[model samples]
Target: MRTIRIPYAELPANARAAVEAHTGPALKADSASEGLNSEIAVRLVSRTGEYYVKGRRASHRWAWTQRREAEVNPFIRGIAPALIARVESAGWDLLIFEAVDGHHADYRPGSPDLPKVVDVIRRLGQLPCPTIELRHAEQRLERYVDRPEDVAYFAGDTLLHTDWNNTNVLVAGDRALVVDWGWATKGAPWLDAAFWVIWLIASGHEPASAEQWAAQVPAWQGATVEGIDAFAVANAHMWDEIGGHDPDSWTARMVDAARRWRDHRKA
Candidate 1:
């Protein structure tokens, strides 16, 4: 479920003051309507410049995600927005990013944004995993797999942006920038490609077409048949529990797409 949005004006006075110290007085606080993670997501315009701010209460259980995103920003320089500042004040933790001038990538079939997105994935795959604290893919998915041993297939030293939701990818003229690093993981090089396959399927691509797109990523070409099968099965089961059988929810829709791909791989 998405976090309930908190209006910018409602943030504690000290927190607001601390943010303004970096951004100057915000002339406008255009609250963002997309994304599930932040309690406060807004685009701010100030005399100084423009910035994108996302925050959670310091006491919130997920506040560490703000720190996680900040910690990973330096390593993913060209592929993501730069983190300009991070503020922890008066019970709030906020991340201020250089406002990217782009729109979300369209994942539908025939969309021109697809190639740029693949390019982003290609560039991302070339970087080594940073020595930061990141969740390992095998550990994160262990409970979802049929057998614990299957988790080994996902272990590797590559950095992964595991979420491929369309909203998380921004497409400018010829580049696609990935955002929301809170869920960044260390995993097999092919895992991010596999993750993208699910979103492509959800976006109306047939299973075969989606896998073809995944193949465009160099790491994906090395995926083993058994490894792909394990991932498909594990992801399907993961979404089943996350969606709770609610047919109308996005996760339920993902559940269907994942199962379709899993069955296709088996056949």
Candidate 2:
């Protein structure tokens, strides 16, 4: 659900007071509209330092998503932004994070950001999945998978950031810092790289070119052909189902992009 944008001024005085209690005085709050995970995504400048804050009403159905992000943040410390503060008050939940100085990554072919993104994903693969309950990629794709046996390919103990939407990746200095862990999963090491493959294709790459880029990761290179094929087919089904309902042009484009990649794998 697209939330009505809540400017800092619109928050209840109590909510504003809660922010001040943690961060001194709020000098400025600028709305940062990059992701769908939160209704109040704002950058706040205080006497202490700068912060990024996101929150939603406790009653909102998707508020659990923000709660999930908070639960998963500490485990993936190096891979994402640091969670600085959290507030629970009067039917609202809020998270404050140390702001990173970076911009959204450019995923187009030959962009310098691609290599950094791959490097981040590579390091992510090396970290053992944290000892917390997380959804498996298999469970995530169960409704979409064409073959039940293929689920085995995604069963492993590596952490997965299932969403690679450009906004969720920030390229800062020499690092590509991934953000928003609401959809984080624990799955096979290669599965995360496979997620990036579809995103690379969405960013104006042909399937072959996207595959070439994904091959930079050793886990992806080692992925069985069957494993990658299973993921592609599942993604095609997921995107197709998504597009069939909304049928917006961007969704339509993504559906075709995923289908084109799946067909290439079959061929």
Candidate 3:
């Protein structure tokens, strides 16, 4: 793959200076896009620890998103990776985080740590963020909801980890930590729960087991099981929009789960 390099001159002076100070010989780096931001990773050696310095070439919109997470992350420490430092250089924003120590959840499924994965989602829901309104999964669904038939059905909100794929979750020891907060938005908590259900099933759990686990997620004081089911359906539909590559059997299973949840909601 071709890689682009960020010149030191293009970064903020403080950030450039910090990178130079830490990375003795000005190590080679690569630029890649992770979701919406231009991301760059450079190797750096420092007295604090060996680290991969990462920055997102800031766009007007994503800059605020990055800054919001940087602001909110410090308060939600145990739930996220530790923030090492922030670097502002030449119109660019860089976030240096304590490198998490584990592979993405995709690599370690059969290790009996699945429940902890569910636990992290539930715990994040329980956190009280009065200022941060959760992004509704319904809004995300509406982006792909092309028909009036779909519109009336997806008219609610929940806290959603817009990207709940296995790749974004990291498993360490007995715990599962969710990373890549760029997509974290408030909506129906069930939207996140439902998406995770699909993820768990795609990762090889039975549909019944996935649904059972999802159903057991404790209500976060203001959410409901019915709301979760709606979120699940919307989540599945959104996944289909994004061209999810799950096998037909997996998609069928998700459809079945959505139907069952919908029927239960109606009853």
Among all candidates shown, the one with the greatest TM-score: 1
lDDT of 1 by residue, 25-80 (tens): 99999898889689999999999999999999988888888889999999999999
What's model 2's overall lDDT? 0.86
Ranking by lDDT: 1, 2, 3
lDDT of 2 by residue, 40-135 (tens): 888999999999888999898877777778888888787899998788776778898889999999999889999998999898889877777678
Question: What is the per-residue lDDT of model 3 for residues 1-267, given as tens digits with 9 covering 90 to 100?
Answer: 112556434566666676655444444433323322334654444555555456666664555656655666654566677767776766667766666667666523464666776788788777765356444445656665445355344344433455676656778877787766766676554556666666666566665667676666664334455455455555556555444554366455555544454444446
- What is the descending TM-score order? 1, 2, 3
Q: Candidate 2: which stretches are off by over 4 Å?
A: none
Model 3 RMSD in angstroms: 5.9
In candidate 2, the residue pairs with backbone N, CA or C atoms under 3 Å apart (3 or more residues apart, or in different chains) clash, namely none
For candidate 1, list the clashing residue pairs, or say none.
none
> Once superposed on the true structure, which residue ranges of model 1 sit more than 4 Å away at CA?
none
**Which of candidates 1 and 2 is the stronger one according to lDDT?**
1
